[model samples]
Target: MSKKGKSRKKPRLPEEQDLDTFEFRPTGLNLKWTKDLITVFDGYRIHRCYDLTFIERAIGEGQMPRSFVDQWRFIRTILHRFAAVSPKIPGVMEKYKRRQVVRFVTLVLLTIAVPLMVATFVFSITAIAP
Candidate 1:
């Protein structure tokens, strides 16, 4: 008896919301969180680094593939959990900013180096022939 054939429905999954594309995109906070989460394991705790042990266990439990253990989704989940538990941390943004600066500098240096090398090669060739 309704005029509209179908009513619009809200998203059922929280993860599916606010996402514009189907492709994966882990937030900067999430990456940092994942980095922090790896410290919980004994091997990782001693090194203060991430290792394959937790991922291997998840794969053994059939939660994820052995190969996909280190995939973006796995890391993102850890990051999301980390974000929930520890939302605020001093100097986190600064670290990300530093990383960005380093990436930019490396790109600029490569750009300049390539052109300078090519120009030097051309100039040397012309000088030797004259």
Candidate 2:
């Protein structure tokens, strides 16, 4: 007699084998095929560029707002909205890169400019006092 506790396990399909982390990873043939196509057409004129770029979100924002999973998604939403206006590949990429530059400037402002300004002010005040 077969034991009731013993159960047969079913094999997982290809779809089920993927992990959640795989969603954000660059996989499959598109990247490789694109590189190959570019190599053939462009030859020596342009080098192959395969970049997996993602947004950077600062600390303390993770899971803060119930809606956003993280800052990356938040930044993505902003960039996506900005790109949605044009929706063309060239236009979207140009705008996205430009907007990313602006974002980087803003980050520098917060991390560097504001702190320097505060330090300068404090130093000037202390210098004037004594």
Candidate 3:
């Protein structure tokens, strides 16, 4: 086939292919959200601490009972699920949608009405004088 006549193939997207074959890894809360949350906590001078070594040690030493590990894994999965659901965009969109519509409508009316209002005031004053 001549190069001019041949069609170029598009690159494959891994996510678009079979999901079962894909190895999905979890990344913790995104940087912006984490930073925002940290800002709120920092504003109040709150301290946060976590010690995950205990879990590692328990697992390495076989001290973690099977049931305990199962429960912890379940809890971790639940937290990850919740984190997946909760984020800033949807909440922000909702907040703006709730209050912003009114603010925007008010702004639009003011923009249209201000000049007319000034004209009316000048006309009324001239009428009063004559």
Looking at model 1, the pairs that clash are none
Clashing residue pairs in all predictions, respectively, total 0, 0, 0
TM-score of each: 0.38, 0.31, 0.30
Best by TM-score: 1
- Give the lDDT ranking, best first: 1, 3, 2
Q: Residue 40 of model 3: what lDDT?
A: 38
Every candidate's lDDT:
0.55, 0.47, 0.53
Worst 10 residues of 2 by lDDT: 50-59
The number of the candidate with the highest lDDT is 1
Over 46-74, each residue of candidate 3 has an lDDT whose tens digit, in order, gives 21223345555755687555554444444
Tens digits of lDDT, candidate 2, 1-130: 7797968798432332223343432233255544653453343223223221311231243412333233234334433444444545456678778999999999988998888999999999999995
Better of 1 and 3 by TM-score: 1
Please give the ranking of all candidate structures by TM-score, highest first, separated by commas. 1, 2, 3
Enumerate residue pairs that collide in model 2: none
Q: Which residue ranges in model 3 land beyond 4 Å of their true spot?
A: 1-92
